[model samples]
Target: MQTQSSFKTTETGTLFLVPTPIGNLDDMTYRAIDTLKSVALIAAEDTRNTQKLLNHFEIETKQISFHEHNTQQRIETLIEKLEAGDDIAQVSDAGMPSISDPGHELVKACIEAGISVVPLPGANAGITALIASGITPQPFTFYGFLPRKGKELTEAVTTLAQKPEALIFYEAPHRLKKTLQALLSTFGVDRKVTLGRELTKKFEEFIRGDLEEVLAWATETELRGEFVMIVAGNPAPDATVSAVATESLSLPEQVEAQIQQGASPNVAIKTVAKANGLKKQVVYNAYHELTE
Candidate 1:
């Protein structure tokens, strides 16, 4: 009663890129299971993780380890099978592949070899968290798990300093506090932030607030679950060219006057920095500005 494309062995015989659920069993799609069962091979980031999923659905398709460590040596063998018209399905341990995962090169090789790749719609913790974050809900950038060291993390955040899009970042539970702290220091404590944990799982939660508030909340409670962080979009500095509270104004009265003229103290400092050809902090030091 199923269509001819029910399994991976459609008339095309292309490789299907499947996305497994991040943490829930019920999230599995029907077409994904049928396709996994039909494919001649199931290339996975972790065979053991995929094993549990396969066993749950009672799928007997053969599993192969195709993670970052050994993919270079295995691509040739995989290509041989594809050339023989044996369709396969590739999956990551969780969520989508090639997005902070190791499937990009493999997928690229398949494409270059004249083999087709069909991506199946499924779960991605980042996008899922973005919608639930209730941030600006506009264009956002996704930066998967950040570099471990503080210096490298700084470089990463600074690289996007001028980007006006909301940013999404994934972080481990242990590194969550440090990551937030680093973001706060680099982006300023007042930047709005949303943190998503245990997404799509029973303990799912989203904490939305300014960076300082959220950072304090994180410290007061025990942090757990996979984290998806959405940071407020960087404001376009060009718009606040007349920010007067920032540069030469050292008194609260002067800063407050600029605020009444529709320029946020932060934006004003940034604007004055450009006008005076100096650093923003250099300008803000004279303004004595802090929202608290």
Candidate 2:
């Protein structure tokens, strides 16, 4: 076991956790491609899907299948590669691999094995949506996707309802309406929400409003493409001494009042943004459109 020979030739390969674009191919970072090219092997959630990306860049590096169904069995093979002096890379079908994806097990196994792991930052649709939603992102929690069952979904959403720093989640097109309903029920009928659909794509759209308004918008629109939802955090209950009491105003209405309180146009816009856990720019645009 601890032989000098074992330590010497052991490659101590680096594991590159690459982040791919959420929608647009142009959003893919150069570093990610470089890492993919240089890695000896890539553990991809889906090989065929990643092959398209590889073909686009002409990266011929071979990929090993390591999806949710096969992750347990593949971890051993992946670890062996790392120990044998071959650097490896991991990527999901889209976005970051470990954030609600199947690559988490590999990351944890690498950590326990004492292998060095490096993560390259790039596009994250969930984060992009949260920041652009004009919601207070700091101290916010990420719940990648909601459970499907009525009972389990309720429990999951309800657990994070008390957070004061907003909540972020991802949802598929078919499940968005149901998840929105769950969010409205858990956070209260009046909670503010920002919904980003088809982010980083031409069809991208952002909807900002209280629960009822946002839910209505979702119902009225054609639900297409991936969805990212940023919900307002629970604010401190009103104590009553000339406090802004952001919770007092409806989301759209509060975003309106920050301007009336002598805050600059931008400040007023961002005030409601932070209060409801969204991006300043998104709120600014909503204000502009609503007033127009």
What residue pairs clash in candidate 2, if any at all? 11-85, 133-278, 133-279, 134-278, 134-279, 135-277, 135-278, 135-279, 136-277
* Per-structure clash totals for the candidates: 0, 9
- Lowest-lDDT window of 10 residues in candidate 2? 237-246
Q: What are the per-residue Cα lDDT tens digits for candidate 1 across 1-292?
A: 2222334443345778999999998899999999999999999999999999999999999998998899899888888888888888989988998888878887788778767788999999889988888887788888788888544555565455446888989988888888776666446556788998888889988899988899899899998877999888878633322223234554454445434434457654554455445677776776774442
Which runs of model 1 end up more than 4 angstroms from their true locations? 1-12, 238-292
Model 1: what TM-score?
0.78
lDDT of 2: 0.76
Give lDDT tens digits, candidate 2, residues 169-280.
Answer: 8888887877776666446666789989989889899998887788787788778888888988878432111222245665556545544433456555544555466776
Residue 232 in model 2: lDDT? 87
- TM-score, per-candidate, Cα-based: 0.78, 0.76
